[model samples]
Target: MSLTAAADPMLPEPFGILRKRRELSDTFTLELEPLGGHRKFAFRPGQFNMLYVFGVGEIPISISGDPDDDGPLVHTIRAVGTVSDALRTMEPGGAVGVRGPFGSAWPVESAEGRDVVLVTGGVGLAPMRPVIYHVLTNRQRYGKVVILYGARTPEDVLFRKQLEQWRSRFDLFVDVSVDRATGRWRGRVGVVTKLIERAGFDPHDAVAFVCGPEVMMRFSVQALNERGVADERIYLSMERNMKCAVGFCGHCQFGGQFVCKDGPVFRFDAIRDIFSVWEV
Candidate 1:
């Protein structure tokens, strides 16, 4: 199907501000309900929404709650710029516009019955959070679930409660590391690539999804390939300067693909060549 044909009907609605606003560290999680109706925003894991803040601006943020949370839609956003800073100031029960459950979702269905490894860094974890939730909630449908996460330091880690819960689950495996130690912190301290060396997996039977800074994705891909994972079995989420979520804007184009339309998620082999071209 054509990309524009995939537009979601739930996109253009004025969602109600259900919980006003709450802080999750330096980021804000806005809980919203349908403004004038009872219909819920339906979406798959890994899909993002274009959240509009009136005069401020709109930004693409991943749907951070469970896909089946029919109650309200949740968006976790960090205050990084003017628009985001404005969003941070929105009171609970205020108004905000949303346009999507846009772009492609992760290949969760294809991952059934296979060993799935999820590797993430920093805020990159936001996009992949739903995928992890999908896998954990439907644990019997997959094989071993391993999550390797890294961040700048302990203070920068997102979803600490969720991460701790994953670590405690006997059915799943969670490993975390940081680039530098902060004296009081006691855990794996090194580059995210360092933890990969000890990530036990039979690459031949595994499907890996990685997201983070471009440099980190490159190194993660190299590590996965070295361990014998097929390029097609490794996936990466791309982050670009996107304007229109629709394909008309060329802001997020990479080679022949539009990151907004074709993917924020792509198979390793599909973008392997362009990834190294410096500029695409």
Candidate 2:
């Protein structure tokens, strides 16, 4: 569905750019404040926004800040291409366009009172970060909160400080892994699935939200199913070449679904049969 013009005003206000150029490993965080105000933008834990850099183009990015905080909006952007590279060059007080609070969000309410496992790889943490924050802030509402994250290497792990804090709070459990470890690394030295195997959560009472590369999500769902989580209970975020965040461009089309509007987040059962086909 296209975002309505009426909805435009409610979109997260374009506040002045906060920290326009801070590097987090190879990626960067472009902090922004609402225009003329310091009031926080209202966004659900797993929603995303389309950020437009003047003359550089736009891309769909997950909102990574706490849903409870009404402060400036923060986005964790990886430097992968031209648009992202340009975003990295933006200085504080520069102007950038934004639209949304878009797409589906993790079912935080439905996961209440149940164990929630978040499996993420690489920048996949961006989308899952809010869910993690929600569960931590309202710890009493959920059962066990487990986070399993894997990166290419030690340098690729995102939100190191936040992950450290989450490690200390609530009934939090975190296992970080890397495909290959450097000399300084002291964590698991394999795929994230290996860590999941070690955590040994009871799948019967748990729900999982997984986001990462398609291959990683596929393997993660397989691992969860092997551990007894039902296909219907496992959720995944599917990535595609999304152009129009409103789902008009058809670039992110997968079979009959639009990854931008219909998903980005989807239940396994809804797309299980289609996933193996590779074309979608």
Candidate 3:
């Protein structure tokens, strides 16, 4: 209906920046809406979009907005490189080109009737936010939702207010920890994996989704295994050097898989040995 063929999926669509809010000093969220009223870009919880900043460049960024929020598409970006820094400077009404909502997603639908454990570190929470949104939207579909987040420091936390609100909900559980604390900060101080022991969930009935630095994800798998969760039940969002958000480019190759096409989200058991190799 949109007059685009799946084969030629590289065309970037026009979008208008509707709003922006700084979540942390270096990271912010951009709210964008389709230009010319194109059919809303629909996607599952863990998908990503290739965002192009006019003349600067493009990069693969996860869609952080709620899947049910029909108002605008949201992306949380940190000012790390040239393109992202350029994007961070954009104001309301800015124009951008978006080319995706690609890659494999977290097994949200399959987690129905079972407990879901989501763990993220640093700005990695952006990709995991949609899963939290999905479960909260369909509260009765899943058994329990456990969220564990860790940041570099107290001031490094992203989505602070939203995290508080989720914690306030009686239906879900949220545990946030900081790697280090500054003045007056007294929350849990350690890596996110340490928070797993305190999280309430049934290993036998639970599915895990982890995203963060490679080290964090690697250790998270060990922690989940220690907690008795099966390998196939643990999913991870892998981050690699990705020049192209689609499979055409080989920049995101990890072992025999291409992160852009095969996954950004993968079952841990499926790729455990591949990623575990020291040379890999």
Candidate 4:
């Protein structure tokens, strides 16, 4: 086996960028393949990896590629900080270091036979893409599949082409809205939570996955609760400030849980008490 396969989980394996696509002005999607031909980075939907950019720094980014695809690992990132900015400017052949596929995943398998509702905003859609891919692949195993996405404006919409393709499918329901309309945009204008009421899924029989800014998630949870989805059936991705992919670093600690190890993806009921608390 390759050293990467046998190495410590904390050791970042070398990888080379295979392709990079500009999704928005500040956001880019990178496709990475292991160097020295290590095994493909296998991970379930919603897991994140710590990406190290040589002398720059490291950041946790969600794996956006389909788990079933025999393709390179993918991460959709926005240039919000130094390390990510360096990654944004990198070319296809640029090198990077990856240390995980870590954290708990969305409970896609457990949600089988129930309606699946995905609510995400801005760049947050990246982590939810894999779940969409899984649902589409095993379409018959689930009931209604609803996707509700919101962006700041039309230009801020990530994965427009992919969203259009998903919308084209008769088996799924995709609705996108913007906080404001620019140019000739004629889509719905509102926060993502507003779309929850009109979504096709039966709230009581649904499993909802939410991600985005914490504020958005808070409101989304409120809306889901009002719509009758149980807290146990609602999940959230708290992808924030994780300096280390392993539990050794306490940067991602929230309440009694460490997001890097115990979560990043958590059931709402499990953290409901602290979920609404400010600056935990």
Candidate with the greatest lDDT versus the true structure: 4
Alpha-carbon RMSD, candidate 2: 2.9
The TM-score values for the models, in the order shown, are 0.92, 0.93, 0.96, 0.97
Task: Give the Å error, residue 129, model 3.
Answer: 0.7
Cα lDDT tens digits, model 4, 2-90, are: 56556567778889999999999999999999998846678999999999999999999999999998889999999999999999989
lDDT score, candidate 2, position 201: 68
Whole-model lDDT per candidate: 0.84, 0.82, 0.91, 0.93
Q: What is the lDDT of residue 214 in candidate 1?
A: 92
Mind giving the per-residue lDDT tens digits that candidate 2 earns over 127-157? 8988987887888998778899999988888
Using TM-score as the measure, name the better of candidate 3 and candidate 4: 4
Instruction: Give candidate 2 misplaced runs (Cα > 4 Å).
Output: 1-14, 20-23
Candidate 3 has which clashing residue pairs, if any?
A: none
Q: For residues 1-280, could you state the per-residue lDDT of candidate 1 as single tens digits?
A: 4556245443466777777444356676788877887677898877888888887788888888788667788888888888788888888778888888788888999999999999899888888888987887789999888899998888887888889998999888899998978868899988787777788777899999998999999999988888888899999989887777888778989898898878889998999889999867
**Candidate closer to the true structure by TM-score (higher is better), 1 or 3:** 3
Among residues 3 or more apart in sequence or in different chains, the pairs in candidate 2 whose N, CA or C atoms overlap within 3 Å are 15-33, 15-34, 15-35, 40-70
Per-model root-mean-square deviation over C-alphas: 3.5, 2.9, 2.4, 2.3
